[model samples]
Target: MSFLQRYKAGIGLGLYAVGIVIGLLFAILVVWADFEAYDFQAGLSVEQKTKGFSCPLAITSNESGLMTAEISNNSTRDANATVRMMHTLGSALVVNQVEQRLTFSPGQTHKLSWPIQASDAAWDRFIMARIYVVGSMPPRSTADYCGILLINSPFFTGQQILVFTLALALVFVVVGWRMWFVSNKQPAIDAEKSSRLMIAFAALVALNIFLSINSEWLASGPLLIVNLLLAVAVLANRLNKSTFS
Candidate 1:
């Protein structure tokens, strides 16, 4: 009989260990991507206030590189607002200007938007959009606002992608060798113990699926702990003595 046929339980445990390690890697990637997205948001939001508009300002960017700003008017009269975009690195502006004009009624919330051809390299700099309220609208009613937007890029850089892929390949190769070759030396576990290990493995599989789908709710540290525990369980089962009695 083949070694796999003689040691089915050991084979299952080895397979489960490989799956657990892979799952851990995926969890790490998810957490890293989440932090990267947060950094982009923090870098792109402009907080400087212009003179003449007192209302709060919020800014967002779309996939097509369009930036939108929602400005609230606190004044009793309507006013025209001129919005302009600037890319700044350090103290100097780096790119061409884009501007738009919009009118906001008293106590009205106005959404101003404009499209731009922002390059991925632009993300390394600060891109800000300023709104200047024209006419007699004093800074007390509607303060001028500067909002920022950033260009989107891939979650992983070229070097990070290359390194991560190599690490994953190495893990797979090591785990594959252990599962197919080393497992042949392990004793055959009884059906009851095998069933119990399989049940635990299945539960972890389900948990991993849930975590992948709803990763935002839980921190990655906890996810990593769970994966480590799963690895321990599978490795323990792989080394357990086989006794039919």
Candidate 2:
């Protein structure tokens, strides 16, 4: 195919390939810089907490437990940052801890140390804590700490990977509808079809952006819903080809 012809047939594919490369590069950079640091306090997970907020984790067995987390800098940029922690304690036992804020710098390290003590009731509860960025809380309830999404199921995470599949399905629908089934009475069918594709593509794009920015808030179930429903839909349509014939 000529250059223009090839572009016409494959622009979407080309854009998708480019997007994948960029996303991979970003993820890799994060993994590389953070490989040695267990600094959970310096990440988006911690940045999602509200200001003047207090969340502490109840650590029962602090056999001289010292947790060190890396203050992550994705690039040459140095960000102004602070961290707060929250931990849940059992009803019988109370926890004694304090919230402290510290300046986080690039190419440097910050240390967090707290003493966790149990009451006479014997702390035996599974405690969970929330580490938040100072004044970095998300306005949406759907957003977990710092818009970080929790993926409990492999099925849901799979939805993120197969995201473009739905858009492709929608594309085929429009193409088939236009070529064979659109009402010619609608003189604007071509433009309407193109507009609709653009809109669908825009929605897909928005889904992706939201999926990226607020992805940390999404659970695996939503992914499964989108994937399975689309899969069954495509299968049904395929099996009904003879009916259309």
- State each candidate's clash count: 9, 15
Worst 10 residues of 1 by lDDT: 53-62
Worst 10 residues of 2 by lDDT: 140-149
Return the top candidate by lDDT: 1
Top candidate, metric TM-score: 1
Each candidate's lDDT (Cα)?
A: 0.45, 0.35
How many clashing pairs in candidate 1? 9
TM-score of candidate 1 versus the correct structure, residues matched by position: 0.36
List the candidates' TM-scores in order: 0.36, 0.28
Q: What is the TM-score (0 to 1) of candidate 2? A: 0.28
The residue-by-residue lDDT of candidate 1 on 79-113, one tens digit each, is 76655544333222344455566677898776656
Candidate 2, number of clashes? 15
lDDT by residue (tens digit), candidate 2, 141-182: 111122111122323232343344345544543453343322
- lDDT of predicted model 1: 0.45
